[model samples]
Target: MLDSLSLDEFGLWAWWIIAAVLGILELIVPGIFFIWLAAAAAVVALVAMAVDIPLTLQVALFAVLSVIAVWTSRRYFARHEVPSDHPLLNQRARTYVGRNYTLELAIRNGRGKIRIGDTLWLVEGPDLPAGATVHVTGVDDDVLKVEAVH
Candidate 1:
């Protein structure tokens, strides 16, 4: 084991700090991904002291471990799981675009209502008569931003 407060101490501390920062960033980004790499860093720190591995090797090992963790996590998520908790996690924002919906009411300021896929959504676009059909061009926060369909 290395002395508790030697040069190795700096390397171990650096790894932990970096991991913690990345783990926090993962929260903002969401994905449960970077936490694994952070775990890998903590493991490297332990292994570094166990074997007295040098600094360059420590960094190289960290890089390799982080990459492996990310790749493995991505593959596991890609092939075997559906997140049950995050409803918008399906990346459904773009799916609404180009869909045509009938206007349920008229709006005076680029806001209205429409139904797409059995779900009535608050809509925004040029004011239209009731029963007018509009094409969705985009979305903003669950609301369909639309224009006249024809």
Candidate 2:
């Protein structure tokens, strides 16, 4: 039975390979799904090499460790995550702060036209030049409100 499998060639090696693949995939996908599984697989491989554990035991260990790592990360996010108080995080999800915008229409009173990102927005603030840098403040409905930065 053992003759059929070589060292680090059985599921132990599979675990390590799967773990590495998952870890790399985690970077591309970036939602923290396979990262834990990868870690668990690595541990399983280490244990299999050091203790000569059976393939079945190695697989079981991988499953348990994967669950533990993923669940532990979920718990951390649930416990430590806090909702942002900024109105824009929900209200104006498309707007970004510190972004430079150009005023397309000068403000006569408190109304002006500015281009933010790829979309043009109607802003309300002090009178600004037609091509002045503006920072997005907040949004109402689909219209973005901005203020002249300089």
Candidate 3:
């Protein structure tokens, strides 16, 4: 069936179909990467329709455009990182930093547990007794590093 179509017609259809497939893949995967490739393919489709370029040149143009699109996206994202008022919003333990809490469990050998907002957090700090006031200083994985408030 494809033998009936000329090179330009085939190139146009091929690029457009590839573009559509890439676009759908981008939606399914949600990586924000394939959309650029789809755009490049669509641009090539337009070029293929308007020009009678050789197949090799068309492939080269598509590759170049895709690379440029990906590079530009990377650079743009690098310069414009997503900024938020709460950088630690997703880090539940980090959010406790600088907050004072009473130790529910005594620190034996620099480890203890504290109750904060109905959650028990494992903490590391200088040895202290239960009921001692401690301030969260940093977070290490699921554990919080704390210091005596006094």
For each candidate, what is the lDDT? 0.78, 0.75, 0.92
Q: Quote the positional error of residue 21 for candidate 1 in Å.
A: 2.3
lDDT score at residue 37, model 3, on the 0-100 scale: 96
Q: Report the lDDT of model 3 for residue 61.
A: 92
User: What's the TM-score of every candidate structure?
Assistant: 0.51, 0.51, 0.72
lDDT of 3 by residue, 1-150 (tens): 866876466546889988999999999995689999999999988998899888889889999999999999999999999798888787989888889999999999999999988889999999999999999999999999999998
- Model 3, residue 127: distance off in Å is 2.1
- Which of the numbered candidates is closest to the native, going by highest TM-score? 3
| Candidate with the larger lDDT of 1 and 2 | 1
Give the CA lDDT, 0 to 100, for residue 49 in model 3.
85
Model 1 segments more than 4 A misplaced: 1-11, 85-150
Clashing pairs in 1: none
Score candidate 2 by lDDT: 0.75
Which segments of model 3 are wrong by more than 4 Å? 1-11, 84-86, 98-104, 115-121, 131-133, 140-142, 148-150
